[model samples]
Target: MSNLFVKDIVVSYSGLPIIDRLNISIPDHKITTIIGPNGCGKSTLLKTIARILKTDRGAVFLDGKAIQQLSTKKVAKRMAILPQSSEVPPGLTIFELVSYGRFPHQRGLGTLKLEDLKQIDWAIQVTGLSELKDRPVVALSGGQRQRVWIAMALAQDTDILILDEPTTYLDLAHQLDILLLLEKLNKEEERTIIMVLHDLNLASRFSHNMIAMKEGSIVAEGPPSKVMTSSTIQKVFDIDANLTICPFSTNPILHSYQLSGCTQDLLENANEG
Candidate 1:
């Protein structure tokens, strides 16, 4: 089990800060979700943790060791990240795409090892893509293509998995399927899963811990019950909404109101009256 800690980190682009002195800790072998409005630096934070984006200030520590000090190959062996979008080769087969995940583990000029084969098989099985293993990546549906990308990440066999908007284009069923797969990986395989999610309800249901950000800073973080409050949502999103507890789970459910013409006029009249 390895813990990821971000200490007072700040990320900037073109001399403008996007992540401002943020501190966060992701527990080992748990599923953590980051939620916020667009451009709130959720993806930026995840990228920094994965070492894709270099931090201008502070440090990211994995298992108490500074991540910057580690070599790229070493970091790749310990952590795998699936960015929001991936570049697909025009004629690459699923197996070829998934095999790229083994690059970090392989030695120079060595053949594919048994462990690699096993890992690739496991990734394919877990992502439910065994049937499409030989198919061309360009031929798969959007959901299937997403699953293939996930399979590639899984084939990396790293302890920490960072995903940015893994369910972006998927429909409801596929989104749930991916969430359940990540949950299983965390619980059964003892892997740490960190992801960025826009859907508040899905984040509350799937994540063991949640971090909510606003305007390049962390606003609230903890279990869904503690962080997903009406006040927090309103403050972060600038929207009036009702919060209720789900019947089965104690997570807060946000019901947003879309003010109509009549309702807006009535509210104004009430204030004037």
Candidate 2:
């Protein structure tokens, strides 16, 4: 299987550093989630790993080699990335949209070979989009549209898949649906899944490993039990998280949160006299 990691990577914009010399290794065939409050460089770290944005001072390695040295097509063959949003053409069909993923494997003239077609079909089937394969992209609901995007990634037939905030703009049920699909893919197919999420409860429930960031640095990195504690939550997000274990999921659940900043606490402490 292919391995992916970043070493001492610094990402900056206009001399302002957003991520400073951060190193992270993604375990093979596991779900790794990056979590942090706003502007903590979670997305920057992910973009660096996907090679979409260049790192100022360090390198991203894939299979023991620097990823930048590899051809774009070579990297695409091993990893697929879904950005926060995609612009769909007005009249694009689901099948047509998904077929674009096969471009990396296409030879001259870009004909869909039998293998590519079969892979596309399998992707649709696995994502539960078989019935909607011929539907127009503009007509599907939010959840279905998200599935279509993930289906497109699956068509790449890669060992690693990266998504940025896949649950955005989705309802609680739809969020669960998307995460469950990813869990299934990781467990059954052993695809390395890396994603960014804002929901601590969901991240705790779903991720095999969690990396929490603050001001371009990692506050915690380990299993959910290690990072979901009240102290870690306070350090990473500046909030005191009330944590409890769910009987069904057995993962840490976020019961609630209270602001940690002294300025935000205006209520007077009243002790029973």
| Model 2 weakest lDDT span, ten residues long | 264-273
Clashes in predicted model 1: 0
lDDT of 2 by residue, 1-273 (tens): 338888899999778999998988899999999999999999989998999989888899999999999999999999999999777887899998898899899989889999999999998998899998898998998889998999999999999999999999999999999999999999999999999999999999999999999999988998998889999998888887779996757888788777886423433442322
lDDT of 1 by residue, 1-273 (tens): 347899999899788999989988898888899999899999999999999889999989987887998888998988999999786887999988888888899999756899998998889898989988999999998888888888988889899999999999889998988888888889899999999999888888888799999989999998998888877776777655567776645677665533222546766987999
Candidate 2: the clashing residue pairs are: none
TM-score of model 2 (CA atoms): 0.94
Q: Model 1, stretches more than 4 Å misplaced?
A: 247-249, 258-273
RMSD of each: 3.1, 2.3
Report every candidate's CA lDDT.
0.87, 0.91
Predict model 1's lDDT versus the native: 0.87
